[model samples]
Target: MDKSAQTRRNRRQSATFFTLGLIFIVGLVVMLSNVYQLDGLTDTVHDRHAIRQNTRLRSLQQFQAAGGRGVVGEARTRSVCIFARDGPAILHVKAVFERLGYDIRATKDDDWDVLWSLKSPYVAFGERLSKLKPHQKVNHWPGLGSVTSKSDLATSKLLSAPVGYRLPKETDAFRAATKANPDKMWVVKSGTHRGVRVRKQVDNVLKIRHDANLFIQEFISNPFLIDGRKFDIGVYTVITSIDPLRVYTYEEEILLRFCSLPYHPFDEAEVNKYVVTADYTPTWEIPSLVEAYNNFQYSHKQALNLHLGRQGHNPKPMWQAISDSIREVMHAKEDGIREIVRKRFSHQNFFELVRFDFIIDEKLKVYLLEVNMSPNLSSGHFAPNKWLYEQIVYNTLKLVGLASATAAHPADVSKDERDMLVSLRDIQVASDRCASAECDDNCKPDICQLCQLCRTPYFTDSVKAAFLEHVNRGNYRRVIPKPLEEQPSTVDVSKAINSTQNNHLMTMWFRGKCEHDKTWCT
Candidate 1:
């Protein structure tokens, strides 16, 4: 009886132990398998991140290599011809170009890569500009005078510009405007001369000579003042293309020219109280901006924004308004500008640098006063402004493809340059395709007008330009062909077909680039 009972008890214990061991083995195998799967997933994510980083790095290298080749292509030595008569005013221009390793040539030097002239070269160098090579560039665009000239600007009647009338032709309109708003003061200015005089009485304007080539504009009496002094912002604007119309402003800093006298106790006779002449007050001279600009080393724009912020004003909207105003003026005048450019041998060889003088009212509303062609680049009047002028020139050159990130000349470019270089051919091969699955490679159908394959050379060039600019735009912000967020959600096919608005292509390209690299968003 004892032997039988003992055997049963042993069997029961053995079976129980065997079952527990099996369960433990299975749990261990599952835990190990899960750990392996987790590590594999992590490795896959890391590999993807590395690939993206490599792709971006490669893309940047390609852009840098392309920059090494001057915009006009592989040139051993780049030369800039200066036609500016204002000697000291353009010293910074020469200095910056020299810093970029450009040889400064006299106006007579016909062999030049860039023609940095005070006015449209079409007047004196018409034949040369008409024969402009693909690699050549000019600082002025034809027909820009329509908006730059005081009388022409008044006649253009740009919405951003103050109410204005060209003399003689619109004298009657000026009289009516004055009668309607008698309290508003007006400033009479010569089309060619920078001199401006406030005209309080309508009789004074009427008494002026009819053929004086003068432009009468409403005076912005209630100016937004800093330290009780009136001021105007000199925004350095650049136009790279005219057909599609690309415009940019130097966003890093702006030139702040404050009136020599306070704006209060208005005096029509005192020119210093209103006009920001060549002898205008500098930023360091303004009490509110002195500390930030001089001691804190804040840029003029930063200092101005800080001051405005402290005064309970949001500078963002003010700046955005300013940008919007600039875009509007360019868009409004594009047809005229394009018409002039079309007469040229090649529009691709031209670019422009102008200073848009803007005045702000007490309500922070921005008004375009004038567009100064070949803006004073010298800091001869204000020594501290030398840095600002140089930077503006340098950044402008970079943005326009006249300057490269590296100082190496084309001949000195490394043998490995091709590896890093992304040529136009490469871009075309990679990007020139229809996104629609149903479309053939040629994109021959009429509906394929928007396709990259069917896009005109102008459209393609615009996209290429936009890509290069996004890469090299250090502190400049593109205003025309507005930022993607500000554009309509859908492309305007009609505009694209007409090539009047290729901004959709640029916006799409920029959006993709921005997704890959946030820095491009700027």
Candidate 2:
């Protein structure tokens, strides 16, 4: 080979090597730019995700602050405090604690996990449900509500009770009634219609009013009869929440309290029979079969059925009528109830027991005669044999949780499933709730047996919105005020209460008042 040919070959090889090196450098720069763009996109997405998580966490924080039990786990604390003294209502609740193995005491202890307020309000952290020694109100009527006082009657006006007037704290009831209506057959009661005395004479009204709260209402003469006997029924309701007053009436567990005497109004001998009470026993010296049947130690339902069928009227539909009345009365006072309870505690964990006494007329129309706050829950009245008040204790005990559920969000739980409020009947679905949890020896049982339930979501956007949403769900019936729509003739608030007017107001008392236009709670 010649020298010139060798030099040309070297040049060609160098040129080819230079071209390859430039291409490699250009490709490396393009790859680095792509990598930088990818990182920038990832950071944008991560920052947005972080913002969303923080927003959700803030929302959850607000919900937990308002009386909501957030993120309640399966295990419940076994200890509780009985924030009540020795009484039928307190004693009955204590019995339930004893049976359930909950460490219950007359006074609350720091180590105790749950606070049983009985017929009272819930005490918050560092406070007590009952302080010092046990205190008992001789008269549960003051706060529990009464049928005998003017203020109470006004509050109960929402209940749409029979047209009645109160004698004030100690005003002559008989005189007042006689003064109100000289010709009407008004029944005067010290506290309730049961303890009432009906007379055409207008004497001694002042003494009765001075003795206690007095009320005078034209007597419900046409009461449903069981073989011509007058009787009243007892209903049990539980208050799970107060601010958003959530009440549940026991449909299955109820009692029928029958009057010992037959329904004979004018006869002085049978007038006592016209009055029904739990402790009343017939003058067994002339004890009739109904009295014998009542005294013979019968099952609650049996006694009720006998009393109900003695007159041969189906108790089922009659019961539905009674339920409507009870619900109507409670619905009327829901806001007031919330206000009353909120004055003490707004925590959703609060609960209470209320007893309602009702009497039904011959037309199957029910009248809400009276209400008992922390009513007589003596086992002897219907216990060991009757399940009316006992079940109220049972279900309430079953629902109240001792463990404080820590409120958590995606920031804490990393996108966990939402917590839920469940009913005892729906406890069978416990497995689904604990699917993510370590369902070991202890956790599985309570996952079903004990779950908190309320009207609103355990989680919500704002505390106020969530809390208000809670009360709205407490509606016994969503009586949406539709002024523009057709109105039901039976639900007139302004009209004087008459048997012909269905004897009830289906909406809140202030609603449906046609001071001008005949409609109103939109």
Candidate 3:
């Protein structure tokens, strides 16, 4: 009775042990792979941001698990009143923000500490905008004429697109609009489309300006191309404070958007897409377009490498160039932006996201395409060939000092306390001080020469200092690059951030059982 029974029992135990061991090993491998990013064979969507977000999430969880409190006691946290605009990006923003532990609401009360808005900074100053256009305003700003305090950017090695007609005596918008540069191309942007390049002809130019709202700009013809596709570098810039005008650009997530079609200067058919879009490729012409998209496209990092080889420059200089171009444009319209911010958005305090588009010529020179007011933060931006909207927004929130859930409670935040944070009235007091002559953001020797403050030496130095302060910063891995702390600690959960509309369901449920006899699951 013993031998045969004992052998059968032993075999059963062995099988059980083998199955348990295999499961343990599989689990261990999965954990290691996720933590170490060992999926090198294929980089999927999650690799772009999930890995980093998960790391941050785990760190936060571990901090709370370790008994550390976040933003507790008298430290106090803040809640932002977000007035988001309509679109897919904002939809993503609302979803991301709702998950966080804050009082996410829509309000214009004076007590709100911080305001995140999608409304144009100029909307409140529409009367002003109507009275004078962008070019018109730039031209008339005092001290912008030849007798100025600021030095020109071109004097330095920094490449910049020439801004025209700002000096009032020489200003004639019509003449400026009609005259063609060597590029022989003009770009007109009115309400919504990115922009359209027009040939140099007075009739064509007048027809465009007839819209009244149109901004006529010179379009660059000699652009650096990759695989014959026209592309631009999209930089995500954040303005934490406008009083001193703080702006930062993310270096790591610099997005490169390429055109769907090959770069052909004379091809009128491809104009709209070429006016600007890198995320989508044309699907027309059947097999050829599809085949072109498949073969021509590559990730931003890959494109960067290709561009680097083509330009023989490092990431540092390229980013520095891009940042310089942004500053130059800002210098040209400083007062206009400040007025828009002060009059319309003049809250006690707020934050803003500015998306700057730039194109490079075959000479590796950087040109500012435009500063997008309502930046579309869809999956494609700030990181080419990757979905990183979550990461981008997360980083922005961290930079803005939105404390974590552990810091404060929703009931704790009130409209009364927020009124004390810095308001436009407060800034106006200092505004004169900035203009009184002696403040500069972080101006350097190289940047000072490029400072427009020289042109308007009589104008406020505080603002120009901010513009000139960010020069010669060799490209950074990320514009606002800061890796997570080495060890776990309380992460500010006020860390990251929108929305609305609705639909309804009709009617009544009749309790009749069992036509199909189907039941719901647990």
Best by lDDT: 1
- Residue-by-residue lDDT tens digits, candidate 1, 1-522: 699999999999999999999999999999999999999989999999999888877765675665433332334777889887757878888888887888988787787888888666777886878887666788878888776877777666666778888777787888788888989988888876566899888898878875657778888889998888899998999998876677889988999999988877888888899888778888998889999988999999999999999999987777877777777667667777788777655778878888988999998888888888888877677889888889888888898888966544533455355334434543342233346554565555443544555768777667677768766888898876666545332222223222454554555555555555665555
Judge candidate 1 against the unseen true structure and give its global Cα lDDT, from 0 to 1: 0.76
lDDT of candidate 2 over 1-522, digit per residue (tens): 999999999999999999999999999999999999999989999999999888877766655554334443324335556666667656766776667666664352455545555443432333333331111111111133432233365335554466665655434553554677776665676654455676555454434543345566656777776556676667766554333333455544455555766666546345556777656542222233345445775544455655557666666665555545544554455555545544543344344556667777876666776676666666665444335455666654443332113333212322222233322232222334444344432333333222222112321211222223223332121222222233342334333222121112112211322332342222
Residue 374 lDDT in model 1?
80
Query: Which prediction has more favorable TM-score, 2 or 3?
Result: 2
Per-residue lDDT for 144-227 in model 3, tens only? 111111122211222365342222222365465455443356555543444555556645655543343345545677777665
lDDT of 3 at 26: 100
Error of 3 at 350 (Å): 1.4
Off by over 4 Å in 1: 1-75, 405-433, 441-450, 486-504, 511-521
Worst 10 residues of 2 by lDDT: 133-142
Candidate 1 RMSD computed on C-alpha atoms after optimal superposition onto the true structure? 18.2
Model 3: runs farther than 4 Å from truth?
1-81, 85-87, 106-114, 121-159, 162-183, 207-209, 282-303, 310-315, 335-348, 380-387, 403-406, 410-522
TM-score of each: 0.77, 0.53, 0.50
